[model samples]
Target: MIKVPIIKLRQNMIKKLTTFALILLVVSVTALPALGEDDENNFIALDHGYTVDYYKSYGAPAIQASITGDPEFERGETADLKIKIANVGVISGFKRLNANQKRINDSIEETIALKEMGEEEEATTAKDIEATLQSETKYIEVESTGNFQNVEELETGHTAPLSYTIKVDGNIPAGNYELLLPVTYQYQANVRTVTADAINLGITDVDYSREYKTKTEVLKIPLSIKSEPKFEVTNVSGSLIQGESKVVNITYKNTRETMAKDAFARIIVMSPLSTEKSTVRLGDIGPGEEKTASFEIKAAQDATVKKYGINSEIKYLDDDKNTKFSESMKVNLPLEATEEKFSVTGIAILLIIVIALYQIVNVHRKRNHNNENVSGDENEY
Candidate 1:
């Protein structure tokens, strides 16, 4: 055999090692996940005298929320909103730690560990869910105490609705609003195996304990506030006098984005105040438009001299021509005291009494003159 150079032989050996190393690096990068990324855990349950982290799951609970029914609501309404919470979580992959398998030697023990860890699908399950709904704008309010409600569990491919009461401001504009629903839930992160008997941990028929991970996700719920005609008593003119009928002019303003057709303004009057015609017709009112309605109201003679509150409302035809009534509005009207001055009738009576007194005084003066003349004539005779 021919002798080969030592450096050349070492060079061939080095090339083979470099090629082998390249192949190994490629396989490792493509095969298993990188360490400390999604691999194994260091948590060992010494209380149960067992090594945990039998399997590492590669998925978490993916939750999404949406409004159940009509997402659009009217203004000035306290409505119950049902939000449907669903879990769309799915397990991407799972890896069973081989070190635990070696530690558990018996076939029955390994089977038990496999069965316990096989429930990797539970990683997608959301449990002990606590949901809270919040509104960023002042126009909307989440009225439910403690931020609505909570859910026990939401399994994959299933949904559950949580009801919350929300109040919409009457003055809120007609538009879409973004409501935030923050949800906190616990999900199975990993299934840790208990090599010792499960009875020691107050659990029976189970050889594994669940490791839960808490996650917080803020979900957006889109809701729309419907546009509708809203009426308000903007201005009220004309004062009411005791024991007399007065014409009151009330100005109504449409403060919303919709129009009202064939609107009728009505006022409800209680005791000490009355009106023969309570309702007056207004032809049509548009957005930001104002309409004045006249009403004849009478106050009792014994009515107090103070400001009175008159409750009024507007009944109008909607876009569908359906009759609808607006929210009750209030306007303060002052009941003035009767003027402290004489009227035409009082002056006439005074004139008549003065004329009769003047006539009597003239008659008395004539009689006195005639008596003096008669006495003088007798003295002369």
Candidate 2:
């Protein structure tokens, strides 16, 4: 080994120092969490063998609404609306109790606010206490009710009921609609605090707070418009010829959830032999209703009188839109004459000919007998 000069040794020592400084800086940056401030377990309490801690807290009571009515409402009628409200707070009480305490007997009161959870935010035990002490208000809006309903001063484990009526206009079209109700609650909570000391004195912290808000639950309701035009046809039978005209009667019954608007019947005939389609339009039908449509069809010149298929499809409007329901059947067109007619006629003619022949033979035998008697009489003379 060769010994190094004093200058070279000094340069090597400088390089080693630089590398050591860089490694230390990298460790300090990467190990920041290890130097983080200590967590305060002020809210963590313990009992004989139980632990109680307020880890997460909410500032809003659960709101519920119940509606009751005819369960089946139609247009031009008033529907009753009843709603029940309640505050859900049993969880809040359980979280606030100490593990040492077996149960809580005192009433629990809290102020709630809706706040946004910011990015990289940590909840501290002190923030939970501040939230319970603040005042919060929530506003609720229901589209079905067309108004704002308020639940003022709702107590824990309590329910309130409200009722109202809504009238459906006679002219309203029938269909289903979804009622949307959105609720929003607003409040504030303490987020942080820092204290400053007087000159030459200890420091005191000033608490910092943040406003919080939350959206309420959405209420869904299915609302329907009602109408009263019903018509139905059943047991329809007849050949749907292409060009030749034929009449068929279809029995109908109105079995619709809602009434049919502008009730009418339209019959459409389709087939290869049918030249023009047939539709007999009849006017309005009522609910729980029954009606019949008589349709005439003509078979095309090329139409062969074979077993033609028949089907009836009914169309009506519910909630201002046309809806259709259909049924199908088979009918025999008068393609060929049945054998019954020819057989009956032939049998009758054959019977008539046999009777005439028997009469003629009997008359001829009588004449021969007369001749024999005359000849015998002449011989006696």
Candidate 3:
């Protein structure tokens, strides 16, 4: 037989004792009583069943849900909306414990008893412990008011998408709008009972009874409706030359159903462009009616020979005499360079030069004829 040193033996014994103490501590902590009423109300428990019904007492469901749909919504347009709901109330590690608390307690008790009987090495495996617990919530149901309908039986960590068809008002302002999503659901409230099985082990039973409550939550779904200014630039006629001033005729049309009273066209001048007449009075322009406005505009000599955008807006006085401006729009103006055109002074100078050249040529021809005659007469003599 091998001789064992007293120091080595004592060290081995101490290690075993320490390990046993740790196991006992884990079991004691795991078997602690369910949360009390005050603690449950104050703390948002993520795992393990609680004896106090916090959600039901506060008229809130334990299930957490969210809404998702098209972020861009246009006025007077109908669209489909989706609301995604999930039971996110269950705690992570305690999911299984909450579901099969009694079964887990039984397993823990058996393991502790085995350890006390010198069979600690044969305790339950991690897989066996997990198998004894369940993480799914029971009897889950949800319903939506105002814009949606009912949804039922949602499991933990599982999401359900609810669809709805909604339309935005035509006259609604162009901005972010919020819609109310009143949700109602029935879920298992926290009602637990603990029963002692032995000195260090107990079984916890969580009631599967459900309670109903409605939660009105505001879903901040973004809706963007663009303003329809119902105005357009119809006809543009004019020629623009670098370093020259010209009159431009622009036709404005009121495309809206309502009439544009005391309408005027306003132009914004930028680089390479200047306008003496910026605003033109168009009087009243009815629906589908067009009116022309003449503006005196000048282009810089070094302006680019390309199309330039002219920013312009239409200001009108409504029936209440309130001045409202239509959405600013851009009109393209083309600039081109061309050869100098013929003028009266240029034509007169050309005619004078032609007459002078003709007279000189005629006089030279006469002199040549006379010289020829003189030569003939001398030869004859």
lDDT of each: 0.83, 0.45, 0.57
By lDDT, rank the candidates, best first: 1, 3, 2
Question: What lDDT, from 0 to 1, does candidate 2 have?
Answer: 0.45
Per-residue alpha-carbon lDDT of model 3 for 1-381, expressed as tens digits? Answer: 999999999999999999988987786566444434543222222333333211212111234444475566544566666656554444322111212234456677445333322311111101100001111112111122333355645545556666666665655555554444444443433332222333343323322222222333333333355433356899888978888988888888877666778889998988788987799999988878999889888999888888877988899876567787887878878888745788999999999999999999999999999999999999999
Superposed by TM-score, candidate 1 places the C-alpha of residue 244 at a distance from the truth, in angstroms, of 4.1
List pairs with backbone clashes in candidate 3.
Answer: 46-91
Predicted candidate 1 versus true structure: per-residue lDDT over 176-232, tens digit per residue: 999999999988776776555433333323445556789999999999987789988
Evaluated against the true structure, the overall lDDT of model 3 is: 0.57
lDDT of 1 at 113: 57
Best by TM-score: 1
Query: Which candidate model has the greater lDDT, 1 or 3?
Result: 1
How much is 90 displaced in model 1, in angstroms?
0.5
Instruction: Give the Cα error of residue 222 in candidate 2, in Å.
Output: 5.2
- TM-scores of the candidates in the order shown: 0.70, 0.34, 0.46
lDDT (Cα, tens digit) per residue for candidate 2, span 142-230: 22453455543454456665554556554455565544444444323223221121111211121122224344456554455544443
